[model samples]
Target: MVAAYQKLCPETLDGACRELADRDPALDRIYRERGCPPLWQRRPGFRTLVQIILEQQVSLASGRATMKRVENAIGRVTAQSLAGAGESGLRAAGVTRQKALYCTLLARAAMDGELNLGRIARVRDHEALDMLTAFKGVGRWTAEVYLLMALRRPDVWPAGDLALAKALQAVKKLPVKPGEDVMRTIARPWRPFRAVAARMLWQEYLCRNRAASAASG
Candidate 1:
């Protein structure tokens, strides 16, 4: 898939820009200002989903720390290891109580053959979402993130993301950050490459925020 992305890079970026520009004129300016970030490649299978679970509601650095502890302690991020780990052990590995329970449930489900990671890759977005969200800790956001980052699905969008909302608001000169419905409407044209647009928006957000901070400083 990474190889395919490398091959299709030009078409992908061009297509994304065309769609975004068609959606709103400001998207052209944002694209010109921000350019593209490194393409996010997925690590195949359950480890990526496990990492996504660890990322929920936490800073990326903190999530990385927690993931590192989990990996070091359990030697694998499989459902079996997560299910087998004692509560004390998981707590020591930096998992929150809620997350620990979720992880345990996920592990048990996987071990019991209830959740099949391999089969997930073959399904469409809605089906994939349904399959994953059936698990204890996996919600719409987490499942969407998994599909976008891990599955490398082109059309996926995280409308619930506050950062995406802010980016859209700033780029489109909206009076306030758009809610999910507005975002969905604004993002419609970007369809298949919405994920790429999302990457561009995030880059724009970081650049603008940094500039603002520097100016204030």
Candidate 2:
């Protein structure tokens, strides 16, 4: 299933929007307000999960740089190389101390066959979340992001994400950022396509926050 979804990339955002808009009027408005950004599909594998771990609490640029360094040092971002890397070496690659440990743990798990990322696409969202979070460095938000973006699961949402909360507040005209419980309730209607909704919201956020968009640009 993972392989099949990976094949679906190069999937046009236009098609996704049309389908989503047909499913929900509110989503149509969102698509009209902000054109969907191209889906940033990632290659599936241990290295990809390692990169996700690197991405926690950091800017995308920083994460990319750190990944590049790690890749260069090891010649490949595989479990074996990462597990063999010393803490000082990982730190030199710009990984935080905690993240380095997480990466190492993830690498070891992958090498030992304890983690089976390829199997996730066959499971339900809740099961997938549980399976992913069993890994040392993985949590709900990380797993959800992986499911939504990487696995291309339609309904997954990372309610804990501050960016998504703020985006929802601005787009929905909320008086304040919605808490996780509130977000879950509000997001229910977008079910079965909430991942698409998430993409739309993030795009709306960039459009509404020009300064942030420019900075990221």
Candidates' C-alpha lDDT: 0.77, 0.77
Query: Which residue runs of candidate 2 sit more than 4 Å off their true CA positions?
Result: 1-26, 211-217
**Model 1, stretches more than 4 Å misplaced?**
1-14
Q: Estimate, for each residue in 6-69, the C-alpha lDDT of model 2 and write its tens digit.
A: 2234354456566777776666888776666557667767887888778887766788888998
Structure candidate 2, residue pairs in collision: none
Question: How close to the true structure is residue 1 of candidate 2, measured as C-alpha lDDT?
Answer: 15
- TM-scores of the models, in the given order? 0.87, 0.85
What CA RMSD would you report for each candidate?
3.3, 3.7
lDDT (10s digit) by residue, model 1, range 11-114: 56556565665666777777666665556667767778878888888866788899899989989877777777956678888889888878877878888899
Specify the highest-TM-score model's number: 1
Cα miss at 91, model 1 (Å)? 1.3
